[model samples]
Target: MINGAHVILYSHDAEADRAFLRDVLGQPHVDAGGGWLIVKLPPAEIAVHPTDAAQAHELYFLCDDVEGTVRELTARGVEFTEPVTDAGWGLLTRLRLPGGGEVGLYEARHQRATDL
Candidate 1:
């Protein structure tokens, strides 16, 4: 059985990336003495997407408040690719990071308590 999933992003700029993951992304994470940080991301939806990375795809944040999260990130200087919009089944928001990387935040139309 799978206990859970933990994602550790690789970055040449460790400090900046650490801060970005901690301060910018707002995930509850902890930095231990081993020069690694552990971020507790909410459970993901495992959706399909096209990406050019070594891995097939990336993690998508399944949020309950896409609008509020966007507001917070925008207030903190994160650039957004699009405002929260209805996608018929859910709400979607895309954010542009400091290194031109982007992450998608989503809220499902169907109501369900998240396991975060």
Candidate 2:
């Protein structure tokens, strides 16, 4: 029986993604491999990175403020393909990673944070 899910994204630009996860998202991770650093994601942590493949995938991050999170990510030099906007479901924002993929950050007002 599966209780949780985790994903690993292969990248040629791992360092950049590593910095973005650690410095921007502030997720605690364990480092391994000298120049070949890999991050051990925290429980329930959702993360994204760049890829050369053409396949499309998505990752999500839960935030307190969608607007504030967008601002912070912008300031950090992360390019957002979609600005923060409110949909019927929740406040949503989309970002482009250096790995040629997209990640969505959402804040649901009607739903509890823990539920996400």
- Candidate 1 per-residue C-alpha lDDT over 1-116 given as tens digits, one digit per residue, 9 for 90 to 100: 98776665555566676677788777787778776777777655444666686665554577778888778778988888987888898999887656556677788887555543
Each candidate: what lDDT?
0.72, 0.71
- Candidate 2 TM-score versus the reference: 0.68
Backbone clash total, candidate 1: 0
Clashing pairs in 2: 50-99, 51-99
Residue-level lDDT of model 2, residues 47-111, one tens digit each, is 36678998666667777788887887789888989867878878998887676667788886665
Shift of residue 64 alpha carbon in model 1, Å: 2.1
Off by over 4 Å in 1: 11-14, 32-34, 45-55, 111-116
Candidate 2 wrongly placed segments (more than 4 Å): 1-4, 35-57, 113-116
Tell me, by TM-score, which candidate is best. 1
